[model samples]
Target: MRIAIIPARGGSKRIPRKNIKDFCGKPIIAYPIEAALNSGVVDKVIVSTDDEEIASIARQYGAETPFVRSSRLADDYTGTVAVIRDAILQLQQIGWTLTECACIYATTPLLNSERIAEAYQLLFDSHADFIFTCARFSFPIQRALLKTDQGGVIPFDPPSVPKRSQDLPPTFHDAGQLYWAAVETWMDPAKHIYSADSRMLLLPERLVQDIDTQEDWEHAELLYKVMQSLGQ
Candidate 1:
């Protein structure tokens, strides 16, 4: 079985109840649930959450809540890999057979079926252990600046300060939207997802947003509204 696991614990400090919070219209988690269901790639869409409210909302959006997340794995220090691993293991314990899985963030309001399908195709065709979304930095990260304790600015990478933006090597960062991996990769803790064996599905910067703060949430709302208006 191909599954899509969404990790959405309730203890959010930056944005309270962010996983299920309303984004444009419906709960933010609804976007990923709909995308995964519409993609035709995943046979099961499951949500791993400790919050009853979140689980309820997930079920309303057509995702299965096989089990409530254990408090041990829902702590703030728990990593994404751990949550996904726990879900995969629990499914196996229940006698469900899983081949590949996709970890889709519950807060990605702009996530679509197209991107999810693209990542799954790449993972299969490239025979990669993992595949995920990535986006290029608008500016060269090598020329980034940092503030000193005294309020003075300093170049983070001194060597790159003299080089033009185009002269520096292009770099991409995780879009933080989705990750597709084989069941074996999820079982193997030592297999990091960013290694050369994995592949990336690059998305335009306009489609990427890390919604952490209120300002970020507002910005994403605007972007989502525009996309909706464009009928995209």
Candidate 2:
């Protein structure tokens, strides 16, 4: 079975209740939930959250809240791997043995149903055990530098010559939007990205935004409104 797990915790230190914060009218978490449900690829959309309010909102949006996330997994320092593992375990206890699963973040309002479906399709077509969305760096990262304590600039890669932006190979950074992985890979703690056989789905910068702070939240809201107007 193909499932989509959205990990939303109540204790958000950066933006305080960011999961349920209003974004373009609905709660922030609702976007991912709705996208997963609308995505024809996902057989089940499950939300792993500790907040009662978030749980209620998730169900309202037609996502399943099979169980409240444990306090241990809800801690600020807890990693996403733990949250996902817990959710899968809960589902297993209830007789749901997933074959494939997607980890959709609550903060990524830029994600759409089409992208979700496309990512799954790519995974299936490539016979990849895992796939994640990423955004390319507009500028050449080879030219990046660091400042020293002596007030001197240092090249991050001193051995490499700086190439023109157009000449440099395209590079991508994890968009932190979603991850699609097989259940066997997810069950293995040492294999987070579904082993070494993982693929990346490239997304445009405009469609990839991580909302962690108030400024980021505002920026995402603005981008979302603009995209809606453009009929994206």
CA lDDT of each prediction against the hidden true structure: 0.93, 0.87
Q: Write the per-residue lDDT of candidate 2 for residues 1-232, one digit (tens) a residue.
A: 8999999888888888889888889998889998998999999899998889999998998899989898888886888877888899999999997899999999888999999999999988998868999888986778789999999999987755555567767777889999998887788866757346889999988997787678888888899999999999
Best by lDDT: 1
| TM-score for each model | 0.97, 0.95
Q: What value of lDDT does candidate 1 attain over all alpha carbons?
A: 0.93
- Model 1 over residues 52-81: C-alpha lDDT tens digits? 999999999899999989999988899999
What is candidate 2's CA lDDT for residue 63? 92
For every model shown, the clashing-pair count is 0, 0
